[model samples]
Target: MEEKILTGRLYDVQGFSVQDGPGVRTTAFLKGCPLHCPWCHSPESQAFYKQLSWMSMRCLGVDACKQRCIKACPKNAIELGVTQKDVKTGTDLQLIHVKRDLCDNCGKCADACYVEALYLCGKDYTVDELVNRLLQDKKFYDRSGGGVTISGGEALSQLDFVIAVLKRLKNEGIHTALDTTGYAEWEKIAMTMPYVDLYLYDLKHLNSEKHQAVVGVPNEVILDNALKLAENGKKLQIRIPVIPMFNHDEKNIRDTAQFCKRLGNAVEVVQLLPYHNLGVMKYLRLSDDPVAEATLPNDAYIEKLKRIFEEYGLPVTVH
Candidate 1:
């Protein structure tokens, strides 16, 4: 193999994550996604470029520490303004806002922040460096059946680096999993399949138009890739996010279950991931508006959906 030094933009490395995969996996969240799911919990991971995020709660205002960031910004992107009024204290506080058009994401403002309220969303890490970071939790993986889960914005978006890291992990006998949207080219999927033990595949909608409307991509490619994976004997888990006013109708639920049923034993799990508004704050942090107006499905409704999948002889779980 040619000597490679591929680096991937990472947002987080959450250890002991039982939700992402089997056992206690260390989920490495990669930045940059191809999809724009309205119910995306990790809004920070959507962009391919580095982004500055400001949390108003941690800001001490210009009066407390002076305008270090405003002065440090070379492009004059940082400024002090009365962004909001503190409702509990009834105090008018000046907050730092980034003029996104003028800002070049230099991180000077983030560096100048004493309280670290403002920071960059993505960090670059070489394949070896990331694998080493994840390997630190090898003891936990040895004890449990867990390993590392390469999650994203979408794992396949960074296919080469992901494959490189997965190959290294596999070399160490680590059980690897990939949490993806399955929107990438078929060749890239095939390249990573052998290294990955499990595929936490997302199946948002069966209808192409509805999928494109909500996720900003047609489901044809996703469905085709999924069938290929199943045919290739790669393990799969079809993850469905139960969003209200979107795919919560009875017809949609049955249709999805029937589709998963066709995949047969290739799909080891059909996980119903109910929608939540947890990402609303993340959108605010990035100074962007949320696309999802739908509320989360109730417990009873979630259970009903689970039963529908189970009726198709498919193993189902709600999260």
Candidate 2:
């Protein structure tokens, strides 16, 4: 039998990202996540498949583009303007509409839209192809102590592909980080742990009920996984998204500090990611789902929270 090609779907591969991990790194945003956090940063990471997005801001009026998208789409999924109920205040023309159900995410329409008004969100990459692209930045990683970071709709969701690419990178002596939601089987974690040099762990809430209420999943498994990884001698970068009306209270902040203390020396660093509306536009492009209204936590307030963690003898940083 011929050797099989192992491929994975990723919405984006961002280069020179200082925000993802230490040094200059390439971050591959993979598709498919188990959790449904409304305030997720990458809108495309929610689904496990390819998506078609229409950037109303980029669209020229129908007359100017000469209806190229409509002509390109064989399924008639491209139309002119969304229904009044779906319209937002941004664009008056609302030049194109994507009938998502009818659309199969074909790139013909995206190709026709020279202004990038219509575009596909994800692309499939064979394991070797992805590794080669990442390795291109080896010089930068070498000088900066940076490597590749695999983030997802939960990276472990596509366990085999992630394992393949990370294992390859490890063999090449490059550092690797797994930015995960911690919603996977322990066996999956075990296999990938050896390949990952660092774990970017999401610690959303200490209370399971509140976690489930907001993210559609309880925190028990997530918390359990964190402890296990720490106990197993893995370095962890704990991330907390400070959002109003969810997991932003001082009580929760202090509780998180206590929890970090439990992780002991394995807790490498705690990153406080304040809420931002950066995902609003991306959300609108992906679906008709309501973008949960959130405001940026004030720097002063975030600093105050940082002190709580410091008091517990845990190093904390705000991003």
Candidate 3:
């Protein structure tokens, strides 16, 4: 492929994440996903478009600073407003509010904010640009058996850009991993196989009906893709998020392990990712409803879930 710009939106680029793959990795979180998993840790990544993230506490307020963002907004969507009065103290704070309905997400406000109190969550990067950035950590990757991981909202949702980045990384001898939900078409996934060294595949639920009800899609395609990937000799480390209300039952656990067992030696490992409310605050940043509170599964419960996969003779790790 010729060297050129191949821009795609990404919410974050995290470094030294040991849990994502074999070693410390720089996980590029591409924006957008087909499924709306309630327990998602990276809620900001769901939308493919750039999001305006306003931090109220970081704001210097109208009195202390020039409101460049307010003037820069083409839609007049930004306005200075009193923060909602505290019911207990009856004290109202001053803040800037973005009328999301009118806001076009042009990111003009983000550029105008000198304090960076207002910022855009996603940014576009060219293939060459992103590769150069990832390659900066080459020494780290070489020493730690680490490389770059393409994660998402759903990495495959931006398939072309992902393949381009992965191909370049592979050329530079950097191991590449694709952390996907496996909800995308098989053809798209197959297109990424040559560039990807490992697949961090997520298995949400065993029952198709339950899966659709929660995640807004049928699991058949996801399951079929997993099996096919394994059959075609792709390395898979199946990741299962153990949500309390959603697939935590004994039967569900056993069924999942049995399914992995069916994949036989094609399965590399089964990672139990216990659900947490780590991204609940992130939802607030995106002006989305926060997930209802749920207690994280205790260590013993996680261990029990791990043992279930062990019973099936599949390698299991609780993360």
- Per-prediction TM-score, please? 0.94, 0.93, 0.92
Cα lDDT computed for each candidate against the true fold: 0.88, 0.89, 0.87
The collision pairs in model 1 are none
TM-score: which is higher, 1 or 3?
1
Mark the regions of model 3 whose C-alpha exceeds 4 Å error after superposition: 1-5, 82-93, 288-291
- lDDT per residue (tens digit) for residues 60-148 in model 2: 66777799999999999878874232245444453777887788987899999899888889999999999999999999999999999
Q: Candidate 1, residues 1-319: lDDT per residue as tens digits?
A: 8886689999989998998878888999999888998678888899888988888898877776788889989999877766667767777768877787788888888999989888988999998899999999999998999999999999788888999999999999999999999998999999998899999999988899999987899989999999899899989988998888888888999999888877878999989988888888888888745454576678998888888988888998888
Query: Which has the greatest TM-score?
Result: 1
Model 3 accuracy (lDDT, Cα): 0.87
> Candidate 1 vs candidate 3: which has greater lDDT?
1
Among all windows of 10 consecutive residues in model 3, the one with the lowest summed lDDT is: 84-93
lDDT of 3 by residue, 1-319 (tens): 8876568889888888898888778889999999998888887888898888887767766555677889899999989876654455566646788888888888999898888888999989888888888988888899999999999989898888999999899999999889999998899999998999889999999999999999999999999999999898889889999999899988999999999998878788899999888887777666744457667888898999899999889999988
Model 1: ten consecutive residues of lowest lDDT = 287-296
